[model samples]
Target: MLTFQPAKPNQLDAIMTIENQGFTPDEAATKPSMAERIDRISDTFIVASQDQQVLGYVVGPASDERYLSDNLYDHLTANNPADRYQTVLSLAVAKDARDQHIGSQLLAELAKVARAQNRTTITLTCLKKLVPFYERNGYVNEGVSDSAHAGETWYNMVKTL
Candidate 1:
């Protein structure tokens, strides 16, 4: 059976292992980056495992500068309590674990955390190729972006909770 748990300190290494394997070098979060995000958003971070073997994880900052309601970063760090909404910084599954709904489960768990925190939305930026996938899973495509990985086009998506 698959079980979900809050990511632990030691598990950051394993999470990085899967991330490095799934994304391009620059796209993957380095250990220190993951550690920093963990420090900021541990309550919103989670890992999925079966038989104690890591399969996937979803994590992000507890709050970010970008706001979907206006699609702009706050110029001076204004607090939009909604800004505390967790941004899904990373979502990755093991190579052998694709097509198994692990990503969806991770998303559901993340949503739960958001709701518990009184966050009103869940947001993410995805590559063009991933737009449809996120749409099929209930996220809305908001706009295009110049921040694509490896020069690919990116789409901003969000789901209101």
Candidate 2:
């Protein structure tokens, strides 16, 4: 069985393992940055584990705007929990766990939590090719994103709760 739970700071290495595998060096967050996020806003960070080993995870934070800004990724700060939208920073599934539905399950749970907290939307940015994946899971593509992270073009996607 898979167990999903709130991420803890001590599990930084585990989360990074997946992050490194899923993203490029420029796109992947540094250890300190990722740790700070897990430390500062763990309520929005979750992990997927089986037999006590983390296999995937999702990290998000509340934002005042509907779309994610470049600054948010550079500096994750304290936020207004009452914000209308939840900005998902990243979702990673280990290489070995790619074919499984763990990523979808994490997104689903995050949506449920966001709705319960009165968040109107859950937003994310992904490469153009991955837009359909998010769409299949209920997110709407809002056209090209302003982000040029890792020199890769991305698109804005959102799921209205």
Candidate 3:
């Protein structure tokens, strides 16, 4: 059975592997950034694991802003229980695990956490190609994003809780 839970320190390697596989070098979070997130926002950083192996993860910090800023990828803070919005900095499934619904499950798990924390919405930025995938998972495309991350165009996707 697959389980969804807060990430643990030991899972960093597995998470990094999946992250590196899912995103390009410019788009993937650095080791330091991922480490900080695991340390600071474990409550909001969820991992999907099966048989002691991590399959994927959804991680971010709670924020007052509705949309993500480029700084968020580099600077992460602890999740504030009182924050109104939940931002997903990264949601990645291992390449070998793509055909399954691990990504969607990770998103659902995050939404559950966000709603329990009294958040109003969950927001993220994605490359144009993945907009429809996020849309199928309940996010609305809010047009082009201001993000210049990886020098690629991104779309702001939001899901109201």
Candidate 4:
């Protein structure tokens, strides 16, 4: 059974492997950045595992900002329970786990956490091709995003709690 739980420091290697596979070099978070997030925002950073193997993860920090800024990609702050918005920095499933709804499940888990915290919305930015996937998961396209991360265009996606 796949279970959702807080990300731990020991899962860093698995998380980094999936991160590299799911995103391009420029777009993927570095080891150090991932480490910082794991240490500082475990409350919002969750992983899906079964039989002691991590299959996927969804991570981000709570924020007052409604949209993701490019700076957030490199700099992260600890989650503040009082923040009104929950932002998804990454949502990735292992290659072998694709087509099994793991990504959607991860998002659902994050939504549960956000709702419980009384957050107003969950926000994320995705490449053009992934916008539809996020849309099906309940996020609305807010058109082109100003984020210049990875030098690629992104669309703002938000789901109101």
Candidate 5:
């Protein structure tokens, strides 16, 4: 049995584990970065858990526009905290815990919150290889992105709310 809930402070260690496992060092959301995201945790930040173990998590805040190549530090720091468009900053699951719809479930929960908040759209960037996965979930690829994470090619995707 899995439960989805807003992220809490203690879950950072576990969440970081998954983030590290699912992404490379360059692409990984590092501890400080993850801490920053936790600090910025809005109603959008969420975790997937069963019993006391966290299996996955996702988070995003509202923003109107973004630059494709900017890293989180640059992009987020330049933003007005009051930005109104949502960007799915991180969506990661434990390696052994994937293939169980956790990602889809997280996205569904995020969508519900977006609608309740009257958000304009939900947007994210993924490697070009994962474009089809997002497309399967109704996200439209707007264009290729120039990512700050070297060697990674991203595709900007969005789903209208």
Candidate 6:
């Protein structure tokens, strides 16, 4: 059984491992960067664990844009309650755990939190190949994203809360 919980500082290594394996070298957040975010706003960062072993995570900040700007990833600042939207900075699952719908579960939990905070929408940027995956989770494709992060084509997806 997989369980979801707020990420702890001690779990940085686990989270970093999953991140590195899940994304290409340029797209993965650095260990120190992940550590900073985990320590900064743990309430917005969560992990999927089974038997206390971290397997995946969903994390980001709440912002007032229909789609987050490049600066959001530069530093995950404090979540502002007045923000109209919640942006998912990263969502990934372990390769070995791919078929279990863990990503969807984490997304559901994140949506719940965003709604509770009165955020009007949830948004994210994903590769074109993953558009259908986010679509299945109720996110609407708002079309191409301007982010050239990792030098990959990206698409913007949004879900109204």
- lDDT tens digits, residue span 10-91, model 1: 7888788899988888667678777765665677778999998889999765455443322222111222355556677689
Q: After superposition, how far is residue 117 of candidate 3 from its true place, in Å?
A: 0.6
Q: Which stretches of candidate 5 lie over 4 Å from their true place?
A: 66-82
lDDT of 3: 0.93
What TM-scores do the predictions have? 0.84, 0.97, 0.98, 0.98, 0.88, 0.97
CA shift at 93, candidate 5, in angstroms?
A: 0.9
lDDT assessment of candidate 1:
0.74
lDDT of each: 0.74, 0.89, 0.93, 0.95, 0.78, 0.89
Native-referenced Cα lDDT, model 4: 0.95
lDDT of 2 by residue, 52-101 (tens): 88999999889989898888888887657669998899999999998899
Native-to-model Cα distance after best TM-score fit, residue 155 in candidate 3, in Å: 0.3
* Model 5 lDDT tens row, 83-119: 5566787888899998998988898888987777777
Cα RMSD, model 4: 0.6
Candidate scoring better on TM-score of 4 and 5: 4
Q: Each model's RMSD to truth, in Å? A: 4.1, 0.9, 0.7, 0.6, 2.4, 0.9
lDDT accuracy of residue 47 in candidate 2: 90
List, residue by residue over 1-161, the lDDT tens digit for candidate 3: 99999999899999999999999999999888899999999999999999999999999999999899999988787888778999999999998989899899999999999998999999999998999899999999998999999999999999999
lDDT-wise, the better of 1 and 2 is 2
lDDT of 6 by residue, 45-142 (tens): 98999999998999998887888677777877778889988888889998888889999999999998888889989999999899999999999999
TM-score of 2: 0.97
Using lDDT as the measure, the top candidate is 4
- Candidate 4 — which residues are off by over 4 angstroms? none
Candidates 1 and 4, the one with greater TM-score: 4
Residue-level lDDT of model 4, residues 1-161, one tens digit each, is: 99999999999999999999999999999999999999999989999999989999999999999999988888888878889999999999999999999999999999999999889999999999999899999999999999999999999999999
